[model samples]
Target: MKPTQRLISTLAVVATLGVGLTACGPEDDPYGDGAGSGSGGSSASAQPSKKPAPSDKATDRADGPGDCGTPPKLPAGHKMVEPAVPPSKGSLSAKDAKPVCTPNDWIYHGQGKAKYYLFAQDVKAELSTGPGRTKSVPVGQLWVHAGDCMTNPGAVKAPYTCSGNIYDITLDSEGQINSIKEIWHP
Candidate 1:
């Protein structure tokens, strides 16, 4: 072969070898275990990337406040003070009628933690998305303050203060929702 052709053949062989070696390099391992080098002292699967789980931190809030203890429930006369509304329809002010609570394309108001209330022009049990009276809210029972014009329900914590709104809801002795009043707050 000519000198130039011989040189070209040698260069081609070197290039092919380099590419083969690179293809078998550390990053190419499909299993990602880095097992081929035999330095596999620690398997990738064995060690997690993030820190270990916290013993003190709570992942959920169902337990209660202060990261401990049984959480507070609705106070005594809670139901009697306010009435329960179907969660799907949301709450309303005293001046507002129950039918006003349901609208065909209603807006959502924030309810207790992780919950939302839908206010519409009318709510029909036949037309609602959930059971006759229940929704998959953060908590059971929809509560509305009697006086507050704001439609949102308060958070689930104790002493659920009203923000110029009277939740029309009242609680029973068992802390379950009992009634919703048609009367407005004075």
Candidate 2:
């Protein structure tokens, strides 16, 4: 063959061998255990790269102030009471005949450590204190227990039973929650 043709043939062979060798390296190993190499050492280093298991740091972040404890049990013979006024079919207006508390007031007002309230739909509060009722109550903190009833108009005609501890809360003049006491639960 001509000298130029012979040189071209040799270059092509070398290029093919280079690609074949690269295809067999550690990059091709799916397990990343350096199984492709006879010495079992990673191409990048003597040791294989290791990833921590998900459970390794799970305990580190398991508990926090935002976490809630086991819910309190209701006393024997204690029964959940229905709200004096139930919800109606309209936007939750402060002017509505019934009292309505905003959801997540505890988080926004920085009340108690409980990260979340249970029956969000059942909570309600009056815009102003009613006669014979303390201003702090219904306007401050209202407790709701499991089995307590609420009306979610247009959804269910009958009163809806709460499944967990819920609280109706009001913010203080400073936009802070007044309390987080558990008045009732089941």
C-alpha RMSD values across all candidates:
20.1, 20.4
Write candidate 1's Cα lDDT for 1-186 as tens digits.
699999999999999999888877433544434334321111000111222123322321222221111112333553212222333334432221111111111111233323223343322221112112222222223332222223543443323333222233443444333443222211
Q: Worst ten-residue run, lDDT, model 1?
A: 99-108
- Each candidate: how many clashes? 31, 3
Can you tell me which runs of candidate 1 are displaced by over 4 Å? 31-33, 40-186
Measured by lDDT, the strongest candidate is 1
Worst 10 residues of 2 by lDDT: 99-108
Quote the lDDT for 48 in model 1.
18
The per-model lDDT (C-alpha) reads 0.30, 0.29
Q: Measured by TM-score, how close is model 1 to the native structure?
A: 0.20
